[model samples]
Target: MDTSTGPDTVIVGAGVAGLTAAWNLHKAGQAVTVVDPEPGMGASRAAAGMIAAVSEVMYQHTTMRTLMTTSAAMYPPLVAELTDLLGHDVGFRDTPTLDISAHPGDRDYFSALAEVQRAAGMTVERITTRQARSLEPALSPTISGAFLVSGDHQINPRRLVPSLIEALETSAAAGGPPFILLRRRAVEVLRAGEDATGAVTGVRLDDGTVITAGTTLLCPGVSLATVGGLPEADCVKLRPVHGDILRARLRPGRPPLLERTVRGMVDGRPVYLVPRTDGEIVIGATEREDSFDGVVLEGAYQLLRDAQVLVPGAADLELTEILARARPGTPDDLPYIGRLDGVDGLVISTGYSRHGILLAPLGGHLAAGLVLGTAPTEQDAGILAATDPRRTADPAVVDSASRDPSNGHRTPRERTAP
Candidate 1:
C-alpha cells in the first residue's frame, strides 16, 4: 500500500493468469506487483494442465480455436524461459493425445468433434480400436472408435507455479521491477476522474490498505467474480463449474498405464487421463455446475468408473488425491480479457473456463500489451473483441456511455446467465 514502492501495475490474482502477466511485464521493464489472498492456490492448483488446443475443441468457433492454438504454441518458449529462471523444469510433455469412446453416443460425439477440429485446421486421423489399443495396451477392449491427434501436449502446474513464483521473487529481490505479492484480498478498485470512473487509481485491500498503481489487471479467477466494489465485477458473470479430479499412483513395478493424454466420452459425459513421469496419473475431471463445495462422491466415483472403463489398469492404481475446484465459466464459453468500457487503467482477464492452463501465457502477454498501450496486431484485435468485458454490461450494440459506477458496473451480466 506504500506509494513509494508502488508498482506500475497491480494484478489482483496471483494464479497463472496474473503471474504470467507480471513476469512478461517485468521482462519488458515495467515495475509490477501482484496481490492475492492465496497465491498459486486457485483453480490452477486443481487443474490437470492439458494444453490440448486441437483435441479439446469444445466449440465450433474460429475465435476459440485461434486463441487455443496461439496459446498452446506459446508454451515451449514460455516453459524454457521459466525453467531457466527458476533453475528447474516446468514439466512440459509434448505427447500425443488419444481420443477414444466406448459407447455409441460417445463415439458419435467424438467423431463430430474431430470434424470440427479438422475444419479448424487440426490434423486428425481416425483409427480403429485395434490401433488405439496398440498405442496403449491398457486401453479397454470395448472401445468402439478412436482418433489420434498430434498437436496436443501437457504440463504440470504443480511444478510450473512454484517456478514462476521464485522467478518473480528473485527478480524483485535483485532490484528489477520491485514486483511483490501482497497476501491480502483486493476489496475494491479505487477510481478517479470527475465522474469517478475515468481511471483506476489503485486497489483497496480487505485489510483496509490501499495499494495504488498506474493501472490494475484483475485476474482473480472465478471464486472472486462475485466480490463487490471492483470495477466490472458485475459485468463479468462467472459460474463456478466444479470439476472433480482424481490423482493416483501406480504400484511399484507397474508400467505406465498410458503413454499420452487419453480423452474419452462415456455416455454423454467427457473424461480424460493424464500420465505423469513419477509413476503417477491424473484422472479427471467430472464437471458439475451445481455446487462450489468440492465434496467427493458421485462425480469422483464416476471419473474412476469411466477412466477404468477406458483403461482397465485405472482400477488397480492407488488413489492419491481427490481435487475439486470450480472453474470460472462464462456463458458464451469465452474469457473476458480486455479493458473495461469506461474504466480506464482497469483490465479483466478471468472467465477462462477450462482453458486457463493453456491460455495463461497468452493472456498475460495480451494483458501487458494493454497496459503498455501497445497496438494489438490484427489477430489480437479480433480476440479482444470476442472477449470484451463490456459485451454483457449493456444490451446496446454500441457503448452509449462509459462504464459508470452508478449504473451498477459492479454487477455486469455474463452474456447469458441463468
Candidate 2:
C-alpha cells in the first residue's frame, strides 16, 4: 500500500473535535480524511453548548477555568469563519448567564463562587432577585438571588454540528479542500515499521482498508479505550462521565423561559436552562461519573424538579427528548491535546469531559497545529503543557504514556550510565 499517496492526515473520530481539526487542517492545504461511524455525532450531540468559562468554575479547577476562558475567546472568530464559509447561521448566542439560587444558603454559596470568579478577573455583577426577574420574567418568583456573568455564552451544538458537517462537505466539493469522510471505525493505529515502539503510520479501518497518513490523531472521545495499537494502560486514564439531558418545548404565546442561559443551584445541585432561538429549551444534564446507566426516571425527575425550582414553568412545558451519553473524561479534568512524549506522528485529543463543546475550538486548532509541526501560541502552550499527554505520573519520574523508552521518547532510562 502506498501510504504517502493516501490522505496526509487520518483523524479517527468524526465528532465536533475531529471535524473542526479536519476543517482547520484542510484549510491549511492538508489532505485530511476523517474516519467515524456517523459524522457530527458523539457526546457533543446532547451538549447544550455552554461556553461557561466563568460560571462552570470549581474550587479545584481555577487553572482550567482560565484556559476555558481562553477557549471561549476563540468561538466568535471560528464560528464567524464557519458561518461565512457555509453561509449558515451556526446559532452562536453571545449572551450573559444568570447564576441564581433558590434558597438563602445556595445564595451564600453562589456569592462565594462569584467572588472566586471575580478574583479570576471574570466579569460578574450581583443582581437583586427583582432585577433578575426584570431581565427575564420567566423566574419562579421564589428566586432569592442572582449573579450575571456577561461573558459566558452559548451556541446550538445541534446547529453547529450540522453546519460543520455541511461546511466540510461543501468545502470538499468546492475543489480546493481535500476533506474526505470515511464511514468506518478505526480498529488500530498502524505503526510505520517492524519496531514495536515505532512511530504511528496510520490507522487500519474496520473494513480492512489501510489509509496511511503523515499523522494520526485519536479524537474518538469516549471510545478511546476500544482502539488498538495504542498503549491504553499507559495513556491518561479516560473514563465515561455519563450525562442525562432533557429537551422541552416552550408553549406558543408564552414568554421565553430563559432570555439568557440560567444556571442555578437547586437543593445544592446545579441545573441549567438554555433556551434555543427555535423556542425549545434544553434542560440538562445529571452527571454520573463512570456510570453509563441509561436515563433513570429519578434523574429525569430531578432535572424537572430542579429546573422548576428556578422557573416553575417547566411543569407545563412539553417534553421533547431525553438524552443520555457518556462524555469522555480524565481524573484531573484536563484534556490531552499534544504529542505523546516521543511517539511520532500521533496525538491524543480527547478526555474533554463536559467541556468538549467549550474546548472544541482550542483542542481542534492546537491538535491541527501540532500535526503540522507548528507550535501553539505562547498562552495556549502554557495551558497545553498542563494538559500535556507526556505529563509525569505521580512520583514515577516518567510519563505514563512514555513508559516505553524505545518509542523515540526519553524516559527514565538515563538515570544510569550507558
Q: For every candidate structure, what is the RMSD over all alpha carbons to the true structure, in angstroms?
A: 5.5, 7.3
Which runs of model 2 end up more than 4 angstroms from their true locations?
1-5, 252-255, 392-418
Those runs of model 1 whose alpha carbons end farther than 4 Å from true positions after fitting are 1-4, 193-198, 225-227, 395-418
Give the C-alpha miss distance for residue 240 in model 1, angstroms: 1.6
Candidate 2, 257-279: lDDT as tens digits: 67799998876777889988888
Candidate 1 structure quality by residue, lDDT tens digits, 103-184: 8877887788788778767899999999998999999999889999888889988877778888988887877777778888
lDDT of 2: 0.80
Error of 2 at 229 (Å): 1.1
Q: What would the TM-scores of all predictions be?
A: 0.90, 0.91
The positional error of residue 214 in candidate 1, measured at the CA in angstroms, is 0.8
